[model samples]
Target: MALISPFLPPGTINNVPQPVLTAKTLSLRPWTAGDTPVVFAAHKDPAIALWHRRRIEGLEESQAVIAQWAGQWEKESGASWAVCDGKGLVVGRAALSRINLFEGDGEVGYWTLPTARGRGIASQAVTALREWAFDAVGLKRLQLTHSTRNKASCRIAAKTGFAFEGIKRSALRHEDGWHDMHLHAAVSATPSG
Candidate 1:
């Protein structure tokens, strides 16, 4: 057997600072300690906590999480951005995790503040993140998965061009129990006409 060469060379993402991405009404920027309040509040929202299956106990923990998100860029394992509205209010989050540079693939995830829901914030942020993952980061594919019951996430995946692949049986565990997950994916290539 022969060793497979990496699709994207090491340092493709970690070599430079993560760039801020913009959508029509959103800006996805690196997370920082200044976002502690919003992060803490978002984690406490019932809807967010239910879907994300975690809670921030305090501002200190939120700040630590923000710092960890920032550090992931240097580690090249993942990246996260705070999705801000035009006036600079943090409304959501967008991220790429489980990045495998060798395979040029990663997983995508996002969540919007309860107050910011139904305004297309998640869709816009995911779109921007997808573009950056493929074009700038040189990823070949991005996968998105959400609980089958998460209709909003399903819609966001569709709107962001992640084609539905299939369902994974009891793939993720939440507070209630394991839940079936819908898997969606988008590749960086377009068919030639």
Candidate 2:
């Protein structure tokens, strides 16, 4: 009789892995309904209102945006995430949209709660998301738009390795007048691990 192996274990199955991302004391994860309160407050913050699109007036509007984001994520064509602090409180949002799959391009957008500003959180979040976009999403280029007067966002773009492309005339209609938008881009065609 042939000798049998002593207690050979059978192959075990592996469960699907959970998506994870980190940035200093902050973490990035897909947006969810639970983030509505934070989202509402952030939208109403004066700093965000100065350069952002129309303010989300209430919880209902916030919830609608969340639903839209969820649908976009399900389509696997666009993405947005809530930025959470060490305490796991959603402090803001970061998004990559207008995804052009054929060209491997997308636009990056972000905002931070007023209390979280000046902490380098936006810069850190953008950098982390840029890496994820290039590596996980196989994107070749990422773009950003900054209002000419929004010095903070322009600074963040520079700090995050995005090169200033140029300015687009009448890119946005603000309270004053049509605002020129500064374009910034990062081309990740070079191999990155």
Residue-pair clashes per candidate: 0, 0
Q: Report the lDDT tens digits of candidate 2 across residue range 114-186.
A: 7788999999889988998787666778999989989999999999999999999999997668999999999
Residue ranges of candidate 2 with Cα displaced over 4 Å: 1-18, 191-193
The RMSD of every model to the true structure, in order and in angstroms, is: 2.2, 10.9
What lDDT score is found at residue 181 in candidate 2? 98
Judged by whole-model lDDT over C-alpha atoms, candidate 1 comes out at 0.92
Q: How do the residues 75-175 of candidate 1 rate in per-residue lDDT, one tens digit apiece? A: 89999999999999999999999999988899998999888999999999999999998878878899999999999999999999999999999999999
Count backbone clashes in candidate 1.
0
Which runs in model 1 stand beyond 4 Å of their true positions? Answer: 190-193
